[model samples]
Target: MNCGCDEQRRVTVSRRRLLAAGAAGAFAGLAGSQLDTQLAFAADPAYSGDVLVLLSLRGGFDGLSAVVPAGDPAYYAARPTIAVPKAQLIGGGTFFGLHPALAPLLPYWTSGKLAAVHAVGQPAPNRSHFAAMEELERAAPGTSLRTGWLNRMAGSLGADDPFDAVAMGTARPARVLDGPAPYLGLTSIDAFTLTGDDAVKPVAATMAALYQGAPPALARTAGQLTGALARAKALRSAGYTPANGAAYPSTELGAALRDVARLIKTGAGLMTATVDSGDWDMHENLGPAQPGRRMHDQLAQLAAALAAFATDLGPDGLNRVTLVTISEFGRRVAQNGSGGLDHGYGNAMFVLGGGVRGGRVYGSWPGLTAAQLRDGDLAVTTDYRAVIGEILRARCRVGDLAPVFPGVTASSLGLVATR
Candidate 1:
């Protein structure tokens, strides 16, 4: 009875401490404490490297269908009803083949601007979507670190600029960017404005006046909002159109990436940005590599958006941008009765950039034999963090990865050129 009481007290105290820390951080954000201090101090230098774009595939991504291992007999045997046929594949080598739906990316793949790593996943298998995504974003396994890896990376770089890191396509911030780094969440560029700001009565201006000569917290918060409104207004006035004859699909992913390109072109000091694409869950009716099938249409949409993004960026713009695709986890190797895969392990990651060594797949080909499977799931041969770490070190020019990945040695896949 005494021990139980003590445990309850400890839990209450921990919750209180957590609440206090959160409140303080919220207030500090209002005051721009970290960003304000950053601008005042010359402690950290500027990051001169690629603008990293993290694309989150929200549902379980089936790598076996996408980066098909045509050479693996077991893969075909396991997914007898759903394997991507060998003849329908595109740019992969003798051992691997790209799904026919990904043909839109053929040019970039052939030109050595896109690459992929297979048999890659988290440190451990997690079948639950919420738990897997949470762990994926938090990144620090076997540790007490609560900050997201992307936020940690931004903080490490001493990013004070509001545009340094952004979560596009949603007003809510991505869990990956949930630290002290000064970042913004926007549904779109033009949509980022004060609730009541207009030509006649500027709400931003009114708020500024109301907070005039107020305490640092209140005053700074008003100033930041006003400043953001001004920037948005300027961007809206400028008017943006896709460059290099790039045609963006009229889709959410397309628009989000279009905005990202706009920010990059406008020189907004964008270090990192995250966008999400869903509906890859495909637990039923994930048809063949045809135009009318569920998986086919989904992949087509993704391909079109990505191809448009690359086209808009053009060669010069893409030279400084690295886009990576990650999911919480991959689906099962074998198809179920409904002709779909369930949550499993050992997914695939795609890397696209000028520095990427394209036209081939990276990582050891973990065999799909029943004996080799991890409880009916593909065994992970490469840690996903290591893959990101490699990109961070090589393309992003991050000198020390210890702070971001914590004790993980980055893979030497030569997937991207060294800085």
Candidate 2:
């Protein structure tokens, strides 16, 4: 996976550590804040590309339950107890069908704004959550590069502001946004501020004066922090109301996505944003396709949040945004004795945006027959990186993807239209 790039030549800094140092003394209250998400800004304000939203479905997600292969008899045989009955599926084609739980997104799927890619995974099989996720985010399997692919993409886009790349939602660390690219992490928009910064104390003002005469590196870091705080303040002042009557659910995912919509609509120079949703590791009692069941409830929540996001953006706003879903890995082809699944190989990805060629599943489906299974799991026919690389090239205008995903070429699935 060596791309002839020198990792030593690229100077990097942890934005989190930089913030802690910049406000070391004055902002003692900073420790109490829940700063989990990160945001970085681009230097080129005129840069025109889709706002790439990456939704990481953490834990081992069961793609088989979500996107059922009803046409394949082998699929039913493998998971007879847990398989989604063909009669309950929606958005059906000759081969694939959407889980009924994903009904919220069926309109988007039918309207050519949503699509799914099956049989997608890494170059090699990795069932360990930590190792697989680390590799998934790093995205350069055989290379010495430690930077996340999103960070590389930001660097390629000439991102200089601390708000260009954002990791929005829950306090979970977004390993995908790690690298040299200047980014800011916070729980939400309103929460992004220097603690105790009021009219009386004025912590931000004090820090600005303190670093005014500091060295270039120190001063630049301070400036980025202060500048980001100012922008966040402005956004807070301008109260938001979701457009198109889109009602976001009362959940963490819903709140995170609502904020993402706010940032995009505010015309913030948001090039890429990452959000995470966990608890997909259903090892037992996965239940049935009913509302109270585990799989159904999770998918319903996911579809609701995503549907609200798209609705709030509307057609015009959505035209400039592209959202994709990925997980560390997928569940096994066969359900276990407990009626749940274990970590497996191949997975499925959902691509949603105005530019997406929707209404059908796209991928080279290696049949689910026992002979085709990779060690009792669905064999990966298309690399996940290639799926993303195609989107990067077509929608984001990234000419060369080798730096971001070494030794991988974009899939020619025509999944997205050229920007």
Best-fitting candidate, measured by lDDT? 2
- Against the true structure, candidate 1 reaches a TM-score of 0.88
Q: List model 1 lDDT by residue over 253-354, tens digit each.
A: 887788888877776667777777888898888888889998988888888989999999999989989999999999898898999888899989999988
lDDT (Cα atoms) of all candidates against the true structure? 0.76, 0.81
Worst 10 residues of 2 by lDDT: 25-34
lDDT of 2: 0.81
TM-score of each prediction: 0.88, 0.91
- Scored against the true structure, residue 70 in model 1 reaches a CA lDDT of 90
TM-score of 2: 0.91
Residue 250 of model 1 has an lDDT of 82
Candidate 1 wrong stretches, greater than 4 Å = 1-46, 163-172
